[model samples]
Target: MLKVKNALALISEAAKSWYSSNPFQFSAIIAYYAILSLPALMIIIFNIVGAIWGRDIVQGEILGEISRAIGRETAESIRMMLVDQGNEKTSVFATVVGIGTLIYGSTGVFFQLQTAFDRIWESKQTQTNEILVVIYSRLKSFGFILIIGFLLLISFVLTSLLNTFSKRLHRFLPR
Candidate 1:
């Protein structure tokens, strides 16, 4: 009985702390940044994975998954947006600026996540250079994105191999 009461009190305290952190507002902020970041994130991932597979295959797999999660209509809209972004032709300066923008946008969600985590953990940093800190954080986030792209590519290749193996195994076994 005492253990149960102690557990309940601990749970209640944790809940109050979580509620005080304003999780819903943080979630809303993260979602907004994610929406803003999606195009750039997709473009980066497509570029990374497309080099190994093909853009069409990567796009098809990504869109198919998105369609399943959301809907075909939303996926189609995303495809259109990606197409438009790909088709744009720009001058050297504009291209540089666009690339910078894409990197910044792609890292936005991760940056927000870092902020939320810091807030939740009540971490205090004693940094002399704010700009450097921000730069480091963004670079870390970009590295994470690159790792995700690589993992996604590996996953696709592995899945394809597994499917082929499964079919061959079925031929040898009684099913």
Candidate 2:
């Protein structure tokens, strides 16, 4: 009985803190930035994973799986948005501008999330205006992106192995 009461009290406190933190506004900002950055984020991960397996093979398998799961039209739309072909004749200057936008867009959600954390903790650092702190926060967000890429690559490898094994197993089974 006492433990249950304590647990409820803790949850109540946490909920109160979250409620006071302008959660709706914070989440809206995060969602907006996430939509803007999804393409660039996927492109970065695809490049990292593509480096391990052949790009063409990986992309084909991924697209096939996506199409199977979410219908061909949705998968094709996402592919067109995210995957840039070298033969598209994109301008070098435009590419540079896009890269700059990608970095900023990807970090925007993390910056807003960090601000929310500070609000919840009632953090008031005197040195918050330091340039180093700003750079560190942005790098911290980039580190998260790297971790996500690594995890995605691992998922792709594991799923491919399982798929290959399943096919071989199916051949050995009764019709």
Candidate 3:
């Protein structure tokens, strides 16, 4: 019982520390960057996905959701941007440049998230060179993006299977 009490105390202290770290400030910063970079990030994701799935199908669903959430005008703008980005026929150099820009743009939110998480974990130390820190941060954020992509693929597959099963069940049910 004493050990349980001690563990609780430790957890409470950690929670206090995290809350005192002004996490909301960092959250707002991340949100701002996420909004600013959303188009670029979506462009990169849809292009890669467009290779495997029809881009129009994906974009149509995304636009429908976005319209419901944001509004038709905003969704239309996003749709236009995604279409333009994915439809480009570019030279190798141009393609490389575009992808590089997308990576940098997309990682802004993740980098801010990492900074906030480090503070909450209280693992921040005297940092290394600025360039080195940026490089490491970008690499870490890119890893997060890859994980999200994997999770999204899993989600899509699961949803497809579930939808198919539900449709089959409906067909078998009495009206």
Candidate 4:
């Protein structure tokens, strides 16, 4: 079909454009994500220090005032939680809590970046296809990285097993 041919052409052209533009766009995205997350980083540090101290750092007086200036709801919530004592002590430090939060936040940015790139290709559309294909193309390029990660894991396991077996062999063979 003519439409199919046109769509393929568009896809090819989009892929070329995506390849040409990806490095700059991806780096810019990562930089912006780091910058925009400054507020969250503050929240992380405040939470961390609070956990370490076993009390909220920004709950009252001067620090509370500073937090209010930074983020109203967050500051108020932390203040209330600290003062009211309604919520149980988390018994977790900032660095530990932040790992999960960072994972979720980074996952959000990944989807957002995928959406942005797909939109870039969609704007060049000749016919309908899954927007996911553009996203898939980006992830496909990451396959090599994924393979390397898996290989590293396998290598670690194999090395551990070899060490254990060697120890067992030495014991059974009498030194």
Candidate 5:
């Protein structure tokens, strides 16, 4: 029982050390995966467009049609409509991709936490309870990304406000 207690303590200490040392890694990873989500969004849009138009985008030269649809517009209204639609579609595609990436990437930290606990608790003589305790000990470490993301959002809002304030202050200050 003493050995078990020592093992659990070791695992707890290791988990604490890891989380404290690498607090930002999780946020960085989440951000990286979030950025990569662009491809996923493009693929989704490509499929949706193909389904709606009854054409295989890769083989059918769909962009040509889109270009033509905009080019053939003799009226200003038609040109504006085409341009607006294209822009809207592109924005939707990007948003879908980003959200998809964020959601998928959110699971990565959990898997890492699971692996860390498994390694930390894997004694030849250890029982399941110790392993479970180790896993629970590390679960909070996986939440670093979520916390960082929230903080980043708050910072972004604050930065935007600061930019506005700076602009106003610039008008009052000499160059």
Candidate 6:
């Protein structure tokens, strides 16, 4: 039918546009940033969720999920990396510098994604100040990281409640 042909044509055009965007190059760049950011991102997320759930529990739950997706060996290596990073002790000045670095690293992937999106959309906004723009971009990325942490906390709470409810329901039901 004409409708089916039109639908196929639309899909083909979208695919062509997507391919023209050089998605693989963007993906490689994003992956590189993500690798650099993972440690800082994980530390921030753990701290946020650990405030309520406790660090061990949150870390275990996250690592366990990762283990399921990947493998236990890889998960254990990630745990070791986190532990090694966290165990380091330094002077107050050094600590401040490290924290700043971690924040910058954590926001790298988000900033890169924002750049990629702007390029893909061909967005042009009037620039006021370069420093302010950089600050705003970093702050926006940091806000996104915080939102992710909040959502992870909510997910854990919901999963815990659901498991408890399921157990209680099982007790009441005639198996």
Highest lDDT among the candidates is held by which one? Answer: 1
Q: Give the top-scoring candidate (TM-score).
A: 1
The TM-score values for the models, in the order shown, are 0.90, 0.79, 0.78, 0.28, 0.31, 0.88
Q: Pairs clashing in candidate 5? A: none
Write the residue-wise lDDT of candidate 6 on 73-138 in tens digits.
999998887667757668999989988998999999999999888878888856889788788999
What does candidate 1's lDDT look like per residue over 28-128, in tens digits? 99999999998899999988998889988888999999999999999999888766775767899998898999999999999999989898889987787
Number of colliding residue pairs in model 2 = 0
Error of 1 at 68 (Å): 2.1
In candidate 3, what are the lDDT values of residues 14-82, reduced to their tens digit?
889878998789888989999987876676666655556566766776788899999999999888777
* Per-residue accuracy of model 4 over 17-72 as CA lDDT, tens digit each: 77876667776786686566544443444444444333432234325565758776
Off by over 4 Å in 2: 64-71, 83-93, 124-129
- lDDT by residue (132-166, candidate 5, tens digit) is 75455444533554454445445545765899999
The best-first sequence of candidates by TM-score reads 1, 6, 2, 3, 5, 4
Report RMSD (Å) for each prediction in the order shown. 2.0, 2.9, 3.4, 15.8, 16.1, 2.1
Deviating ranges (above 4 Å) for candidate 4: 1-23, 31-88, 91-100, 123-155, 162-175
Ranking by lDDT: 1, 6, 3, 2, 4, 5
lDDT, candidate 2, residue 122?
90
Ten residues in sequence with the least summed lDDT for candidate 2: 81-90
The Cα RMSD of model 1 versus the native structure comes to 2.0
- Report lDDT (Cα) of residue 72, candidate 5: 41
